[model samples]
Target chain A: MKLEILAALNAEREARRAAVLVTEIATGKQRLVREADLASDPLAETLAERLRMGKSGMAETPAGDVFLTVQAPPVRIVVTGAVHISQALAPMARLLGHDLTIVDPRTAFATPERFPDAPVHAEWPDDVLPKLGVDRYTAFVALTHDPKIDDPGLIHALRSRCFYIGALGSRKTHAKRVERLTAAGFTDKDIARIHAPIGLPIGAISPAEIALSIMGEITAALRLKPASAAQAAA
Target chain B: MLATDNDIMNRAEAWRREGKGVAIATVVETWGSAPRPVGSHLVIDDDGNFLGSVSGGCVEGAVVTEAVDVITSGAPKMLEFGVADETAWKVGLSCGGRIRVYVERVD
Candidate 1:
């Protein structure tokens, strides 16, 4: 590993860009492949598969045996409400190594005392989501149950490439939400991305159980294959 | 203070920039119930000082010693550790797992 290569890898991480450090095990030859360059690399297909899986391991290439250190950006959880579920979720998200942020316009709800482990923002989602830079690595959850707050955040999340978007609501509430979003010009296809009636069907009763179900769903969305994840979520 | 993978890499780059001979050991492969997953890192300096863990503190001491040698020789080495009884004299995982570690110098 050259000093320059290590420095470059660190720089890519700081910039929150995905990259892989390819090291040939036999000779110690190494190279850094940024996500943008994956298409042109000779090992493009294999690298893309590994990147999608977000796992680092030994790869047997026709050229040689190599190790790929896949550096996908850490997943960030952006919740639109600092309610009871968020309070229970903040700690769990930290335990799972995901960055969790709580946003709510209600000062009483978004108190530091309530969410000691997470950053509590006493602001609206529309005002904060942009600055948070919710990207492909983000899991956006609308838990406020307030259309004024959750609707704007949903719009932002839909426009961005956030991997997971869930909303806390029942089927009836989601129907209303769908109507509003449709009136707002979001096609049914774009609106379909949201996991309304949020969380997996675990028959959750309490707020903490609800949080666990939501977290479980998010983990499935992240780790499972797309087809499997859809099946699990369904 | 739990060190993330990024923190280990950052520390490795920082140590090298500070003019210290540094080596990084990574768990490249794992079989069975290995304590740490593949791609886990442990960065060491010439002085045998290390940060991070390739195997939940089970074989880090051995890795650090080899990493110091790799730093001095500038040649990467592949190291394997298995069950304690299999590696009678060597440090091994109590969890009955096998792991392959790659130790390389940062030049």
Candidate 2:
């Protein structure tokens, strides 16, 4: 690898920016492609597709077969409510390669011992959500079942365009939650982004099972047709 | 295949800086039923010690052999392993596939 390319890649890794290292197979010509560079590359269209999918693969171009090693930042998960589900979720999400932050104003449940190895915060959603830097590569999971705890975080997530937004509740509970979000000034489409009755319909009973379902949904949202590609296809 | 495991790139760079010759073999392309996804890496140090994997095991032996030469010659090379009837029989593959690997020196 060229020193310049390597240095550029290291800098991107430091800043947690998405980047791609494209290696031209025939001549071994290599260059770094940051997310912002996609629109200008000769292979812009294909690169855009690959970036949106967050995948690295061999792309056949007019020049040659170029191998793209996509390096998207690790998905950050802001899990509000350090409840039983979150206790199970923190480690599971970590095992699945996600950075997790547990936010709950209740210090008893959000203690370091309760969620060891994860960054725990005894701060409210409005206080901690901005500090977490929730972005497109982030996922927000609301498990508190309290509007005070979940609503602010969900609104922040919706505004930030985080890849996934999920809230825990029953169908009726979700309906009321929907009314609250609507009244709070979120559009219908924005309110629809929340995966109310959070997690998949897996008939999950235990906290661990519920956590597994949430992780599955989060992964699906991250890997399978991120909203940009879906909108492009639409 | 949805995730990259055991980051081999950083290990390769560190090994080279530590005064050991290192080569990295990466899966550049795959066809048919390949075991590993594209961009998977296997880092081989001068002593034939390797970390990470391009294939589960089916093609590591061949890729390592190429990586050794890349380390020795300081020249990168691309390797192609395709599913022939004999190769499928030898590797005990229930399916057929093709893999293209690029082996290059760390420095």
TM-score of the second chain in each model? 0.95, 0.84
Give the distance in Å from residue A8's predicted Cα in candidate 2 to where it truly belongs: 3.6
Candidate 2, A1-234: lDDT as tens digits? 654565566567657688888888887788898988778988888887787777789889888788898877777899999999999998887677678899999988889999885999999999989977887788899999898998888888888868788999999999999898889898898887888789988999999999999998988887676665323442
Docking class of 1: medium
**Predicted complex 1: DockQ:** 0.60
List DockQ, one per candidate, in order: 0.60, 0.39
Listing candidates in order, what is each one's chain A TM-score? 0.87, 0.89
Q: Model 1: per-residue lDDT, tens digit, A1-234?
A: 999999999899778789999999888999999999999999999898887778899999998899999998877899999899999999898877688999999998989999988998899888999999987788999998999999999999988878889999999999999999999999988898899899999999999999999999999888675433322332
After the best TM-score superposition of candidate 2, give how far the Cα of residue B89 lies from its true spot, in angstroms: 8.0
Model 1 pairs whose backbones collide: none
lDDT of 2 by residue, B1-107 (tens): 22334245566666777888888788888889988888788889888888887777877877777788888998889888776565344432234888888987766
Report the Cα lDDT for residue A55, model 1. 87
Q: How close is candidate 1 to the true structure, as a TM-score?
A: 0.84
